[model samples]
Target chain A: MKSLIDICDLSREEIDSLLDTANDIIAHPEVYSEKCRGKKLATLFFEPSTRTRLSFEAAMYELGGNVLGFSEAQSSSASKGESVADTARVVSCYADIIAMRHPKEGAPLVASMHASVPIINAGDGGHNHPTQTLADLLTIKREKGGFDGLTLGFCGDLKFGRTVHSLIAAMSRYKDIRVVLISPQELKLPSYVKRDILQKNGIPYTQTTDFESVIDSLDILYMTRVQRERFFSEEEYLRLKDSYILTPEKLRRAKSDLCVMHPLPRVNEISTAIDNDPRACYFKQVLYGKYMRMALILMLLGVN
Target chain B: MNIDSIKDGIVIDHIQSGKCMEIYRLLDLEKLDCQIAIIKNALSQKMGRKDIIKIDAAIELDFDLLGYVAPGVTIDIIRGGVLVEKKTPELPEKIVGVICCKNPRCISTTEQELPQVFRLADRERRIYRCFYCESMSK
Candidate 1:
């Protein structure tokens, strides 16, 4: 009856349960492989996302579920001027659950109204990607050993980074978590985030333009690229593009146990040379994404 | 035109003039067989132009539905040609099953089964967020 719509829908206990399920699926793959056998996952990707769509497909396939639906609006019934709700209604007859990615703000939310199946928001126009936050949670729990009492630093485009916003919202529930925000003046965390999630909950957080000065204090470093598209001018983006790239040299200033993370397809933000360092968990983050998704598939299908 | 007052009916007052027809259409008032009278461009001090709708039949109002289309409007119930009760709907705390959050990627939008549930994050400001997506509008 529940869907992974936003990270907030899952409480700390629910998230912990999902994580436990993920761990169990990882440890006992055979037991959960046929969990959703004969069920189908309908992927309604209105926007192009090869990676996320693939992850969902791969997750469903590994769970013995058939995958259907379009990769883009151009290929689907969307070309026939069908509304998101109508598409979802028709698709529900064919699938047990739907994973949707759209460029519009709430297209998936609208579709949910008429759907007969659980709707998973794959991603929405810089709005939300709860599964990504789930993956990040798994990465943090695995890399840092636990969720509580950690100093986390989020650097780069905090303004439009749905990943960053979701992570902050999800982590605010944990104990003794300090957030050190690093971004240019224009691309900083929105006030609502600070007010609604941080201050309202009394989560300890500090903002700074100085990433280099605070690198050593952080236990987890989340790197997001400064999206040029979100900016109005090239000159402004150029000035802020390299403001906080994580290079091999920068890693020297960081603590030995610091884990570096990036939502990949990364540009010049995190240097390729730094991949050799044990602290770089961006690649490992991707693998953890699969495990977490596998865990989600099992949990949602009621097999776990 | 002068007309006799009804014994019981629901009166919608202070509707934005041109929007009354839209609200009527939104409520599908045409389907009703009741004698519904619509007053256009009525005099109002608060709103420069207002419309009024009086349905000359005993009709119960759905306050939750009223909140969606006419949150700013006030409604009065008349009994025996006397104003017996007045109901001014407050905006819903959480809007479910009506209207849409403008966020396309919001799960409520993409999935066919779930009703669009938006939390009225700011009532005075008329901001609603998807309960599933966190998509907001001012």
Candidate 2:
């Protein structure tokens, strides 16, 4: 079974193919309306997630497949202390594929070990959210036309931002990709990520506390929220939550074609006034996320 | 300070000084009923000081744990007071149930039956990352 537990699990060619399929799905949605006919998708969310669960359900429905499974652990057998392996084995009998989200890291990996069908990791604690990286990739492909020779600026909460880590890992394979990491000292990108992904790949990078000074040089500005769920202390979260706020004034020095993005559910990190600024692609990222999910479902089911 | 040579046993040599206790603890040497000797801060020509452990029984050992805790240490096997074989444990590709992942969000933490697994991520740095969460082993 080919389960996407991490972004690195997919090669550059595979990602390109997924992007191609997503583009095709966007161009002609009717052609793939029956791609997954008679198939079933089980959304096994052990944690509360609105966007990811809905996106998976919506993708399956669009592919003419039936969707089942619980929205949270409280509603599922997990509440009764059922193991993830057992749940996966049981769900594999009903669904052709499984999209799982859990509070614990590597929960989906445990599921994939026992699942007869492919397991898509929607999100696993603060470890990995590969599909979100897929969405970011597709959005970047659509905006910049390719992954090479781009200066990408990642701002805020890089420590716990799984999307940023995964994307950097994915983008490191491309040529001439320069990274500008903008965050406070407290939430800087993890050293392992810098050493393993960036430095090992010979990708030039700059780490800075000043966001605006480097904003003008970036092609893509990925703004992330300071996630409270990732922090152990509320005091620390409060101290770093308002570190970087993307206002219209902040973009004055940035390029007109700069693509500003966020993973969504923004809590004042991105100003509402900048949503109309044509440069803000965060909402579009959500839409692109759905199309990429649809493409992923088709590929995983071998219906594409 | 002379320790008698065992008739049939294993001698672990050249452990970095002061690391024998950790290896002894991790290897659960205290659980064994056989005679065990730990010589700490022994003078060495190669190393300024080293530690050696001698077990008076040819017992099975967890080489992965040994490799992780004390790399480059030599293991000498003896049978009938004659040298049988000498082995050096290499950094294992994967280690299971050797060390628990400290990441609170790792699945191995909540799953009681799950085996704690860590993979060697960097050889030069001797870094082991949790297989479940990829957090660096401290």
Candidate 3:
């Protein structure tokens, strides 16, 4: 593929190859240090995302490449009325690859259309985050051994959580996968997702408002931040935020081998006390984020 | 009373009767310099009631698009006061810049320059999904 706009953009074989490459990068970091020695990466973050922007920059730096671009829209030409198409066209001249995070849902797709180089969607609105899905995949492979025959439980704000949407779509391609969606009424997974991706693929899934009831059957529990920004009022956010928190008491009911996952920059959905727990793989997921990005850059640039 | 036939123009026939106004607005028929006639509730053997549009100008017509809106549409080309070509349009595999995706999270909603494209996902259900965000196009 010319660009990575969505998780489905990569085939099952391609996803497997990317995971293999990530494993290689983790194994022999020294051997691949200078792989992109003279190449450059442009991170055009129209939205403010410190974690995703830094992950892309760090990935490029580890490959012996340079990084450039603005972290926010005010600092870039976007504020001066330059379109994403024009910005992508201009940046493609200066960089070998471009990673973009925009508040608009399809801004990266627009950039990909105009850009000569590869355009990776860092995080676009609440639409899709393919790289985060990659990190989640790598972590799942490491913690659960494989994707087959696993019950994954997703908790908290599934409606606006891009990571949850992306991970579920990616995991649907695997064998014997069952998804348990745990969320409040307002935060339930969008019906289009359940209809298009899950039901259309014939993948079995169950939805519930209670996490305790389904905790023991899950092999992986993905916790998500119940963002204050997603709610209409602060009172509503407060009411739902504490409902899905993954506390030690809640963990008692979960499977012993359950791998607790989360796309970080969390806002109280997961208790900090579980940070030391071996089953909490979110921190390792952060490290894997860099490795997966390294593999993504290498693959996109066609470097060894 | 009969609407005068066009000597050199295009004829869009077999549209579902009540949908003529929608097709007229979509095709921007009001802006055309040629003589145009909207024949509504025309008696037909194939269809009980149909709409026919005849334009006295040879403009480029999107047959696939016409088929998408009204699947049973037929296009006829007239030259030298006689019918030269006849066409029955099929539903297009994908429609570009025709219908906007109503999904708020769709990329096309924000990227004003990008053409709103939809691909036929389920033929039996007549379902179309946006090309960018994969949301159903209403």
- Candidate 1 residue-wise lDDT, B9-124, digit = tens: 98888887777887787677898998999889988899988988888988765656567567678888998889998787777788666767665445555454667777878666
Clashing pairs in 3: A106-B107
Per-candidate DockQ versus the true complex? 0.30, 0.73, 0.55
Candidate 2 per-residue lDDT, tens place, A30-142, comes to 99999899999999998989999999999999999999999889999888888988999999999999999999999999999999999999999999999999999999999
How well is each residue in A91-178 modelled by candidate 3, as lDDT tens digits? Answer: 9999999999987777888899899999999988777899999999999998888999999999989998889988999999999999
Stronger candidate by lDDT (2 vs 3): 2
Model 2 — interface RMS deviation?
A: 0.9
lDDT of each: 0.83, 0.93, 0.89
What is the DockQ (computed on Cα atoms) for candidate 1?
0.30
Better of 2 and 3 by DockQ: 2
Regions of model 2 farther than 4 Å from truth: B4-9, B16-50, B55-62, B78-85
Model 3: interface root-mean-square deviation in Å? 1.8
| Residue A24 local lDDT, model 2 | 95
Tell me, by TM-score, which candidate is best. 2
* Global Cα RMSD, each model: 4.7, 2.3, 3.0
